[model samples]
Target: MIGVSGTLVRGGTSKCWLFDITDVHGRGASLEDVLLAAFGSQDHSQIDGVGGATSTTSKAAIISHSYESGVDIDYTFAQVGVGVNEVEWGSNCGNCGTAVGLYAVQSGLVRPRGEQTTVRMRNTNTGSRIDAVVDTPGGRFTPSGNATIPGVASPGVAVGLEFLDPVGSTTDALLPSGAAVDDFTLSEGAAHATLVDAGAPAALFDAEALGLTGAETVAEFGAALPSLLGLRHRAGVHMGLAAPGGPVSHAVPKFGVVGAPRDYTATDGTRIAAADYDISVRMASMHAPHPAIGLTSTVAVAAAATVQGSTVHAHAKARDGEIRLGTPAGVVSARLVLDGERLTGVRLNRSARVIARADIFVPRAERVPVALP
Candidate 1:
């Protein structure tokens, strides 16, 4: 057995376990083998390990100090599949980046610079740069704080992330298809999709085109999971996320539906009015609906809104780089800094807390497959 210690941190709306690079790979084991075993990917319920089983919870990242100029930390995000026994390393997680920022300074990877310490992170998975401004009072780290996010009830330390140069995070262009609006031929029929590569590659279709309001609850999104995955596959191919007639990723080219803002009941039973938010979105995180909007997807939504004919742009109400997205949990706000046609950065307020520190044990290196490419 291989025993490795990891930190469990709740960043933004999701939870991810952070591990030091050396601890997981000093034995020369494959990243997927270690992470899959650590998260108990073989079991759907993850009863044998620390994985929370849900898409948002079953996540892990390897952290290390970066020697790269202008970057303080580098991390590789792994979306460890539940029951599926797969680990997807093709995308970046904004929520995970939030956790890594706090983890970096808290663990002394980066020296805290009083008041607001900036931890510049590069997600090696997608090559996206995120400036995580952590709240370090008097140059000291605090484990918890009064800052709260939309989905989580508990408050934590505030970390504002500025996604620097987020355009074409995975692909090479903001509009990967070279157009703001691209028509994707779905199995049922043709659907017009706005495929934006900012933050992460995301393909958004008008919710009405899919026979539902974008403000639908998580369960509603789950009910249409099959159709959503199908759309994601096609979008991935269109965005060059995958080769045509090739194995498409179920993760990237984030699939979702967008709609005009309207009245809806939140998961917490709160009433949200049309005027309260700019647009509505129901995004699928892997196999199910993301209970709360992923910040990276929020970045994509904000980027798409800037386009003239994008689906998100067509439904959004807010202007001047302020985007308020209505999710299942509540509304998430993203601020875009623009210089003429150039998008300087995207800033978002998030809360993160160190949930637990644990020693995880997994099967020996030779016992797990190292065949994943």
Candidate 2:
């Protein structure tokens, strides 16, 4: 039997289990094997493991104090597969980055500085850097406060997540195809897409073109899943994320449909007016509709909205400063800082909490030959 130590934390809209790098590597087992066993990846319900059995909840991270200059923490975001034995390391999660910030100080990885402890994290998966400002009043670590963000019901400690130079995390180009828009041919039909690589690689389409209102609730977005998933594959190829007729990435080029905000009811049944938000967004997580926008998606959308001919820009209302995203949960605010048309970084105000420190015992890992990222 293999014993694994983990800390579960609620970061923004997702729940992630963080494992110390030492614990993960000290076992002498492949990361795929250890994570699969710990998450019970072979079970759809994840009934036998700590996994929450959903895309947002079934995530894990390996973290350590970084030796890299100017960086304080190093982490690898692992999108552990649901009902399958696989892990995707091609992307990063800003929400998890929030959790890492808090966990760093709480775990003594970094010394608290004054009131705001800045935990500079380097995502080893995508080589993206994130500055997580954790609230530690008077140089004291604290995880609970009067702060809140959309999607999650309870309030927690505030963590400011800033993605620095986040463009081209995977493709090495802001616009992976060298153009703001690309033509795609999918089983659903033909459509124009904006394949941007900011924060995380993502493909955005105008909802009207996909026969969508962009304000559909999670349940209502069900019918459009097949077509959007098909679009993801085509966009992946166009962005050079995959070769022609090759297996596409399950994470990259995160798919989203955007439209001008219209009066609609949120998932919680709260009415939101068209004037209240700048744009509407419906992003997919793995195969399901994200209850709220992912921080990475929020970053990408804000950047895409700045492009004149991009899908998001075409549909978003004219706004200044922070961009408001009308998600199923509610409106989310994301700000893009630029220096004379050159984007510097994206900023988001999120909250996170350390749920628990746990010890998971794995009897035997399922035999699955999944590759490391």
Candidate 3:
């Protein structure tokens, strides 16, 4: 039996259970079966496992001691959708990165000191250095504070997440195809799209092209899931981001609608009035729904909104350099540093809490092949 210690944490808009890959056994089961057991199959209640039902709560991360100097740990992400059998490992979840640093410190892997502790993590998926800062009171991570972000319902200790060299996370180039935008000819007609690979590969399209106000609620889109998923699948192929009809397991090359803020009702029935944000966004996770948005999508949304020719730019306000976006939950604020046409850096804020850490026990009866159907 292999025993592993794990921590279930909430970071930004997502929650994840973190484990060390070295401690876990059985990579034998197909990703689908593994995810089903990990997240509790057919159970949105997650009565038999740790999954929180919503995509935000259906994530997991594997962390290991880093061999590289100046980096504390290596992070790998796993997206386990509610009913899906597979776990998507194609991209990194920045929200999950927040918990990793704290987990490292709490587990005695790294020493935490002063009020602020900075931990550097190497994202194995993207080969990016993510810097995380936590406020420690009395030499431990403390969540009792007035710190707050717009999206989360309650305020907790604030953790600042900075993605270093995010300009080419998924692909070697910010504009992977060497063009600011790609001209894709759908069955209907040809439409211009932007392909940005920073943090994650993302395909950008105007809201109007899909008959969306860019201000629609989550329900409105859910009602059109068939078409929406089809659009995403087609766009994935169009961008040359994925193979023609290949598995849509890769969450990169995310599809989203960008439009200037207009008065709209949020998923929570709150009014996301035009005055609240400059742009509106709805991002998918593993081709499933997300209660809120993820960090990578937030970066893509901000980058597209700031660019001059994208559809989002039309409704964007001429403000300071940073771009603020409104989502189903609330506003997600981020920054994009532009070095002429090249993207230099991306930054954002997130929250994380350490739930628990203890050895995960694997019974001897399971010592045989961890079988899956």
Q: Each prediction's Cα RMSD? A: 3.4, 3.8, 3.7
Computed on alpha carbons, the lDDT of every model, listed in order, comes to 0.89, 0.88, 0.71
- Model 2 spans > 4 angstroms off: 185-189, 366-373
lDDT for 368 (candidate 2): 55
Off by over 4 Å in 3: 1-3, 25-36, 41-46, 186-192, 338-341, 358-373
The digit string of per-residue lDDT tens for model 2 on 237-256 reads 98898998999878887888
> Which number leads on lDDT?
1
lDDT of 1 at 342: 78
Which clashing pairs does model 3 show? 4-360, 32-85, 201-253
- Model 1 steric clash pairs: none
What shift in Å separates residue 36 of candidate 1 from its native position after superposition? Answer: 1.3
* Ranking of all candidate structures by their lDDT, best first: 1, 2, 3
